[model samples]
Target: MSPRRRRTEEFTSYYGRPILKEPTWEALDIAGYIFAGGLAGASSILAAGAQHTGRPRLERAAKLTAITAISASVAALVHDLGRPERFLNMLRVAKPTSPMSVGSWILSVYGPLAGASAAADVLGIFPRAGKAAGIGAGIAGSAVATYTAVLVSDTAVPTWHDAHAVMPFVFAGSAAASAGGIGAALSPLAEAGPARRMAIGGAAVETAMSFAMERSGRLSAETFHQGRAGTLLRLSKALTVGGAVGIALGGRSSRAVSAVGGLAVAAGSALLRFGIFEAGRASTLDPKYVVVPQRERLAARQEEPAKADTMG
Candidate 1:
């Protein structure tokens, strides 16, 4: 084939321009990794605050949860990479242009510290200074969670990119709530106050951000309110409310309540990721999402004569 024809045959953007594919189910799972790390980090912060306030149980709960969640987050990330060997390749050529590439480096740095801090606590090694590790790890973990929002938002996916302004807060809120629910399940009520409080705050933020995202763009919002995306939004709202109420009532004191509620928030967050990913794919599948806006822009441009032509 001629060079021009060869180049023409290659896949490109939705509109025959160069752009990445919409996120897949695998990508959704990777997004969950981000959600988990964020929750883990937020939990650590809450626990640290509890520790400073003389709440040993909350502190321990936070420390343990951050470690466990971060580990899970890393596991999901590796699982998404399709191979462990290729994971480090992310760092080999730090591409600021690619969000996933940057996120890989962030996770790599944060994952180990989170595991080590948790291990130190579990083994009682450096128990005296393990608190320091918890603080550090938790902060890094939070960054892991929130930064993914930026990663997804920076993409060309209409649903993901259009929701850029509110996506981070939504992810952060969901993460905080998930960790708090876990803490409530594992820690005593008195010490779990911080976690419970976080749950409420997170639920509110997630809900608000989601609403804002829907309002920000019609196409993006359609993904959430239609079909499976609608189902996720519905489930997320129900679970978020239930979890918040459970936390407020000090459900942590009850294992069943804690277990059920925590799982709800965690599941809800994962669903949100899937919903977002699917929506991006759906947006790409229909030319309306891609062409409508571009057509409007062209028509507007055509109506406006060039400066030189208009002046003549």
Candidate 2:
């Protein structure tokens, strides 16, 4: 392949611009990601709460959120594809190296299982089935929440590659925090202990991961640390801190505080994805990141051949 084509493949994007210039999407995509995160995160919080207390409210919230999360995951995915017909094409290959592919498969499993659990809850029939569905939803929702970290990490960009190991936890935390924020706003303050804890914990995790992703120096680390990403990083820290504090202070039922905190965590999570997307593109734009890493691989591959020939 020509150097230009090769560079494009490694870097990402149609050209120098972002794939979604305005980041505009159908309502489904927008709501789906949020719902998915909320569902999974909320489900986790409820599950945790269930361990301590068996309030019917918490259980109801968890079941509803998990189902909603799964539904949104599916909707967001379909919207992401831009065409209902293109869905199956995504599964043509199971490339371990491809984050999008891996994420798709994960979401596919998480979506249906979680939705079924919620559906069971909606219907009064089959108490046994509802329990089974809830378990399935919990498992699937958690996966949907965490795997996004790997999705970002799987990219060839400097910022993402360097922080691969930590991103999953970060995503998981952010998702949970988002759920907690929502629950706190809607649920009674006294009963919101689980939600508050989850939100605060999630915020902390996201803040740390965002810092780590920015601090790494592989290639586009600067990209993440300057300009838009820099702004985002600072914003994430502020929001996470603010949100965590707000949740921990026992005032979550306040509409204003909860709204701000929820928006903050959600923004942080979304920006994380956006920043990574841009950073990957930037890393690929320059020939050095691609050439440098691949060259090292080739060199390592060549050493084995040379050593074998020498021995022979």
Candidate 3:
């Protein structure tokens, strides 16, 4: 008789159940929080820059926008929690190893500074204090802009976890783009030149980082190319590209064109955040994603000893 052929066994989960816990965050609340936090963070920096340059209108606009966005983000975050009052517990301890803890502290510090700065601008109180608060807000805002990536990546979600290295760059770029877009839309064309330049640079960085993320060899990269997540991300890319082109060609000449471009960039940033959130959720629903990578890792570990032995 011919030698029996060996059959390869496939890894399987019980009843095909997911091997990982699904994210419990609501799409609207959590994703909105992400967008608003980023916008607020970047806007704070813009406000400080405008202040230094003596652009009163742009400074005022950015300060107000930053305050509003951060307040909204805080509200959204509270609304997302199962126990809203428990949110304060995040501030109880400062754990450098915990991204969530770090983020809470960042927001707490940024919020007061941002609010004080905006209030000072509106009430014309304590010019030096306002400048100091604005400066502090700008510094803290940089942390706020990028720390959300750390928050998400700290989770078990495959796509978010695997993309940790590049996720901060992606978030920072998107934050800058959104802030620039808002600045461009709200400020005069003459006062908005810096915003326009910031938008272009931010969009370029955001687009390149996103492309690199999707091309990374992680299996989770597939999440960006299929399903609802795919559709939104694809639309985000298209809008971002189109908006960048419009800004490049007409940003200097037409306020209307610049406003439209800015709006597009803002919309793209929102969509990208929502899409990433959805993709991470989708990844958890699949057993293969959870099981396969882990199995491969285990196999690789097992092979290491043999390779060491052979080398020795």
Candidate 4:
């Protein structure tokens, strides 16, 4: 009998180099920007809601969170750009077609509004102006929370680009969860109701979207399931779920529990952003994550034409 032959698939590149260049973004800076931006944006929204509902403490905490987080987010972005002027240059042109341009504009508008709102809350001056600014910040914050998703997905990274459909939803959920966490942690027990609800709801949405994105079974999705990215994502999910549960159970009663749970949720949100950033970078390291998907698409297109010819 002839010896049996086994065939294995291997992905290689010219000189074993990656097909795509890895992103030059610093992990800490960019990932921190993503986390802080989401947190700030959602906190602005929560602040408006709290103000409308007459929750004074919650409103103040949320406002403070919005301004602080956004400030940190801007700092991270500027640091990553290597020059503060680079950020300002992005604002000179408003290109609706470019996520970066739109995002730059959003940050510029949202920052002042958030600062005014926070200043009003802290300094107890210009209450009327602050309220109006808070509302404006809320409106802009909506975009700030999810715009990063669009910004990153607009890139050539396989994992991020491929997951575009669900990326915004994931970011929105993460933002809400983190904002809720901060609110709950800072607010008194009597005023923690809304924060707890937000935390639970956000966690649910984030968890569902994360699962859906990963379960798509695409080759790139594998980056999210292996290595450091995988570990970080897994931990993020656990902390988010645990934090949500803790808030649900003890948030209404124990101040200590609520604070711990809220912090956990925020930590999880940060880790989720980091994990996603890592996954996108990891996707660029291996040629298979890029080449295989393109080859598959090409094969499918060729098959479609052959089928059409046969039908004709």
> What total of clashing residue pairs does each candidate reach?
2, 1, 0, 0
TM-score of each candidate?
0.82, 0.72, 0.95, 0.96
lDDT of 2 by residue, 268-311 (tens): 55555555555555554455555555666788898998999999
Ranking by TM-score: 4, 3, 1, 2
Model 4, span 1-312: residue lDDT tens:
311111104557789898889999999999999999999999999999998899999999999999999999999999999999999999888899999999999999999999999999899999999999999999999999999999999998999999999999999999999999999999999987998899889988999999998877777887899899999999999999999999999889999999999999988999999999999999999887777778778888989989999999
- Residue 54 in candidate 4, Cα distance off native in Å: 0.5
> Who wins the lDDT comparison?
4
User: Which residue pairs in candidate 3 collide?
Assistant: none
Off by over 4 Å in 1: 1-28, 95-97, 249-262, 300-312
Query: Taking the tens digit of each residue's C-alpha lDDT, what string does model 3 give over 1-312?
Result: 311111112546899788788988899899999999999999999999999998888899999999999999999999987676768988889999999899999999999999999999999999999999999999999999999999999998998999999999999999999898888888898899888887888889999999999899777888888899999999998888788789889988899999999889989988999999989999888877776777678989999999999999
Model 3 TM-score on a 0 to 1 scale? 0.95
Off by over 4 Å in 4: 1-9
RMSD of each: 7.0, 6.6, 3.9, 3.1
Ranking by lDDT: 4, 3, 1, 2
Model 1's lDDT to the true fold?
Answer: 0.71
lDDT at position 54, candidate 4: 95
Q: Flag the better candidate by TM-score, 1 or 3.
A: 3
lDDT of each: 0.71, 0.62, 0.90, 0.92
Candidate 3, which segments miss by more than 4 Å at Cα? Answer: 1-11
After superposing all C-alphas onto the true structure, candidate 2 shows an RMSD in angstroms of 6.6
Candidate 3 lDDT: 0.90
268 in model 4: Cα distance from truth in Å?
0.7
Native-to-model Cα distance after best TM-score fit, residue 180 in candidate 2, in Å: 2.0
